[model samples]
Target: MEAVVERFLKYIKCDTKSDEETGVTPSTPGQMEFAKKLAEELKNIGMSNVSLDENGYVMAEVPSNTDKNVPVIGFIAHMDTAPDMSGKNVNPKIVENYDGNDIVLNKDQNIVLKVKDFPEIKECVGKTIITTDGTTLLGADDKAGVAEIITAVDYLIKNPSIEHGTVKIAFTPDEEIGCGADHFDVEKFNADFAYTIDGGSVGELECENFNAAGAVVSIKGRNVHPGSAKDKMINSMLIANEFIFMLPDTETPSHTEGYEGFYHITSLKGDVEETKIHYIIRDFDKQKFEERKYIMSAIVQSLNKKYGEDTVSVEIKDQYYNMKEKIQPVKHIVDTAFRAMEECEVVPKVVPIRGGTDGARLSYMGLPTPNLFTGGYNFHGRYEFIPTFAMEKAVDVILKIIELYTKA
Candidate 1:
């Protein structure tokens, strides 16, 4: 357990924050450094075939101890942290024997993890925890996942009596930018099934995620002098507003939950001559996901008719889809995870994710992957933290899952 926390602390300080604007495979050089370090750690733990590729994906194999034709399983976690905040110079604080009260993260900045806001913090009473200062994110989003998987592998190696099948592990890059699975080699990964240790909190086992797509509305307008702007001036920003108004006001991230779909406006920037509105259309249902994309195009067409031809242009790109379609065929993969959690004394909370995961894409890519919890909370922000006992439980869960599969 101490080793797990020590490894996690070492990882978060590496500053592997990914950049979406880089137009490169990793989008940041720091990710490569982290991948190299993880590969070395995997090799050090007696993992075979430990290799880090040029695309910044690190892969390794743990051989099966028994020869009963067990299925090849995989565990995946991302190496890059979110670009939403600074991952550099992360100074993590360890709090032992939490007293179930507000935690002062930064005394000078008045950054506190208040009990009034997050009731979950109180759940870790008497347990040790790790948190960041008010300055930067803790990078536990997937780093914790990475640590848990590796720690479990190390345990299996140390205790050879716990028989298991072939285990494949991968650490990916650029998951925060939505391209984690873009260049993934399904054939090379070679797993009958997989689990991404990327879910938030303990017992969060997710197999369903939103079928998603991106819609970019480009508005072309004519700027004219104020004196003669009565008929000629077409403010693209006004057109963009009309497009936003056309959508269902209540159907958004802020207002929706539990299988509810949403049209999120990610970015909006413009002037008199041109305006661009970036939106993400999401739904768990395939038909509704398509309908939402059509609605965005319809709104653009209506405005184009009101303005002129080519005045409103939309570029719709399919990002990723619901993994439910892929995983439903292999339901027992998720069931095995639930049973594994129960074996670890962790109650399984099977919930549908409102957003997507790299597992969602990997499942569609023939991995049949689902998501497992990392025991971290408030990832990708300054308030991020993880419980020490929760991580120990996660490592136990992984070991138990392999045990169940091998024993069967």
Candidate 2:
């Protein structure tokens, strides 16, 4: 069997960084290249109906070996890494039998993964852990997920004696920028239910995620000579800063957790001529989510009233909503995951996702897709790492879910 760790190490080297500015599906050429490679891999692994679509969505089917009819299940993961960090030229370091000490990721650069900052590293004791060299993200956000699903399917195909039902697998692109399901052909995929193997840590099963939206504030200001700019000049950069400050300071991502919603400022860039601030609004409550958008719009209006009419323009677009509503109607799907986790001896962590996932959007698209873990931590950053054992365990969980589904 191909090791999940080996697959992850190889997949992360592809430099599949998604670009939000791009209009095309997959967003970047690297994603398309990666998808093609993965599609070929699926075919080589004996998966049927293996296809890499124009949008870089790779879908494959694992034919059922059982005689009785069983519901088709799908497992999904994203191919693109977050735009927040560079996924290029990644150099991974392995720590064997981690002793729970501070790991120095780059000795020359003196970059260390401090235990104090990330105490969770202690949990991976006596296991092989993979980490970045402090120069780039590990891309474990969903690559680990990709590896786990593939490894599990490979195991199923190799062990045809282990009775199982039809299983579908999908690898999506541009999930980080919130367009993963925008072009998803759920009807064609033909799954009764699905799970996105894209969560953090082991044994995480998430059905609830944030109700999300994006707010873009465009600030236009007049640049004048500092010598006589007192009343004549309007500093749009300052106005942008004020617009951000107008939002409640305590309601930001850093200040909230565990069912608490947040207003995350993703980017702020500008000069006096023009400034654009990008923010993502999230909430678990539908009403609160709407209120948050209202607050953002009200702030933009107040800034416009202060600066001048049309000086500050704001655009708020609704992203994915909480999947709880969709998943609740099919709660047994979550139950099956919990049972599968127990069978795998993985203590299930049923938590609400603070951020959204491709599964959340897919759930609303008529697929009650929950989320599973990749056994990774500190995702989308330099400190990102994953335990080899945890990743192997994820493969086991996937297999267990397939087995449990056949019994059902």
Best by TM-score: 2
lDDT of 1 at 360: 89
lDDT of each: 0.90, 0.93
TM-score of 1: 0.95
- Give a tens-digit lDDT track for model 1, residues 1-408: 677888888888898899877899888999998888998889888999998889999999999888798999999999888888999999999999999989999999899999898899988999998999879999888899999999989988898887789999999999987889988888998999999999888999999999988888999888999789998899888888888899999999999999999999988999989999988889999999989988888887888788899999999998888898899999988999999999888999999987777998998888899999999998889989999888888888888888888878
Please give the distance, in angstroms, between residue 156's alpha carbon in candidate 2 and its true position after superposition. 1.1
TM-score of candidate 2 to 2 decimals: 0.99
Model 2, 369: alpha-carbon shift in Å?
0.3
Which digits, one per residue and each the tens of the lDDT, describe model 2 over residues 185-294?
99989999999999999989999999999989999999999999989999999998888889899998789989999999999999989999999999999999999999
Off by over 4 Å in 2: none
Error of 1 at 85 (Å): 2.0
* Model 1 whole-model lDDT (C-alpha atoms): 0.90
